[model samples]
Target: MDANTISHILLPIDFSESSLNAFETGVAIAQKNNASVTIIHVQDNTFEYDHTNLHGNHKIEDNFGDVLNALADAAQLKLGKVPRLIMGEGPITASIVNTANKYSCDLIVMGAHGASGYRELFIGTNTYKVIKYASCPVLIIPTKKKFKQFNNVLFPLKPLPGVLKKYDLIRCMTSNNQETSLEILCLSSKINDDDEQLFEYLLDEFKERTEGVPTKVSSQYSFGNNIAEIILKTAEELRSDLLLLTPSIDISNKQFFIGPYTQRILHHSKTPVLVIKRNN
Candidate 1:
C-alpha cells in the first residue's frame, strides 16, 4: 500500500490522554498529506451487562448510543473540519480493524501506553493485535511522544525473500516533504564475502527504486545476533522521528502470530512505529 496515496486516515480514540495525543498527531499527519481523518471510538460489547429486569435493554442501548453521540460530537468540535467521527462496538481490535476497512483508510494512527487499565487498548495487547491483523499500516505514537516533522526515519532491513517490495511503501510516508531523510540498517548475524555482495546488490536495488523521490537515502550494514537490539540502538542513535518496520508473521493457520523481534520492537521502541503489514 502506498501511503503517499492516502486519501483517508483512521484514528481510534478512547478519550484517554494517550488517545488524545494520538489524535493530535494524526491531525498533523492529515494536514501534511492532505488526507481526511476519521476518528472512531470503540465501546467494548463485553462490558454490556444483562439488563433484562433492571432498566431494560432498549433503555441501556439508548444510553450507550447517547454516550457515543456525545463523544463523537465532542471530538468533531475539537478536531474541527479535518475529521469525521465514527462510533463502533465489539472487541477493541476487531472494531478498529473493521472500521478501517469500512473507511478504506490507508493508515491507522493510535496512542499506546506501557501500562494496563484503560491505556491497554492502544499499547497493551490490543496494539499488537491491531498491527498483526490490520490490512493497512498502523502508526503508533507513544504517550510521551510529541508530534514533530518526521525528518529522519530509521528502517531495519531483514534479507528475507520478496521483502524488498515493502520499501515502496516507505516512500509514501516521506513523499510529502523533500527534507525527509531515510537510513536503512541491513542486519545480519555474520558478514562473509557472499553476504557483502548480496547486501550491496540489495542496497543498489533499493537505491534505484527510491531514486527521484527527493529524499536523501543512505544505507549501512551491521553484523548482529539480535536484530531487534540492533534496530532499536540504531534508531535511538540516529534520533529518528519514526521507525519503519514490516513485521514478520506466520498466518498459515489463519491466525496472526508475531515474530519475537517484531514484538520486542513494538513494545520497546520509543519512537513511533509504522508497521507495514505484509500481504498474504
Candidate 2:
C-alpha cells in the first residue's frame, strides 16, 4: 500500500534528543497521512546497582513505573494526537519490535545513533537492533536535523536478493514524487567490462520501475581502500539526503554485508542510513 494508506504508526520515545528527533519526524508523517501514533517507552528494568541492603525490589519496580507514566504523559501532551503508552520489562530493542508487531503498526520512526568499535559489539545500538528485527517500515531520524532534499539518494547496492527486493522500502520514502526526487545508486567495489554492461542494464530496469516520475537513475563503481568511506564521500559530493542499505554489516569477521565495509559505514557515515531487514 501507499504512504497515505498508513493508518497507525508505532513511535518509540526515550526522552532523548534522538528520540525527540524521531518523534518530530513521525509527527509530520502522521499528520500528512492522518495516521494515529502510539508513543512507546521501552524501559529496561535490568539496571544493576549497589544494593547493599538498602532498597527492595518492589520499591524499584514502583519507581520505574512512575517514571514511565510521567514520560508517557508528557509525550501525550506534546503530540498533536493522543498517543497510547506501553510499559514492559525486557530488553528495549526486543520489546519495541514485539510491541510494534503486536499492535500491527504500519510504520516505526526511530532515532539512529551510530556506534563504534568495542562499544558497538558489547552494547548494540537500539536503532540498529530495531531496524534489524522490526517487521514494519522504519524511518531512522538522524541525530542532527541533517535532512537534505532527496534529489539524489546514495543507494549502496550489493549482489543480494534482499537488496533488489527491497525496492518497496525505497518507494515508500519517494512515493510523493511531486515534492521529492528519487535516484537509484549502485556502488560496486570493482568493475569488470561485463559488470559495467550489467550495471547499465540494471539502471535501465530501475528507471522503468520508477516510470513516469521525476527521478534520475545512476550507477558508480569505486575501487579503493575503504568502500564505506568512498560511499559517504560520494554522497557528500552529491549532497544526498538519504543512504539506503540492508541492515547487514560487513566487519572482517562479522560482516553485515558480504564484504568488510558495512560496519565501517554504520560507524562513520554521517548520511542517514535506512537499514532494512532481509524480509522487509
Best by lDDT: 1
Off by over 4 Å in 2: 1-7, 48-82, 114-124, 146-151, 159-162, 175-179, 247-260
User: For model 1, how does the per-residue alpha-carbon lDDT over 1-280 read when each residue is reduced to its tens digit?
Assistant: 3533666889886654566677777766666566777877776766643323223444334554564455456545544653677776778889899888888888888877522354432356776788888888888887766764577888787666665766665555553655768897877778777767776888788778767767777888888678888888999999998888874322133346567787788888888888876642
List clash counts for every candidate, in order.
Answer: 0, 7
C-alpha RMSD values across all candidates: 6.1, 6.4
TM-score of 1: 0.79
lDDT tens digits by residue: candidate 2, 1-280: 3432666778786654556666776665565566777877665656432221113433334354565566556555555567777766678888898988988887888766521122422213777677656876676766656342234567766443334555555554553545444455455556667656666776677778777666666666665456677776877887776777654334222322224465465556566666654444
* lDDT, candidates in the order shown: 0.70, 0.60
Estimate the lDDT of model 1.
0.70
lDDT of 2: 0.60
Index of the highest-TM-score prediction = 1
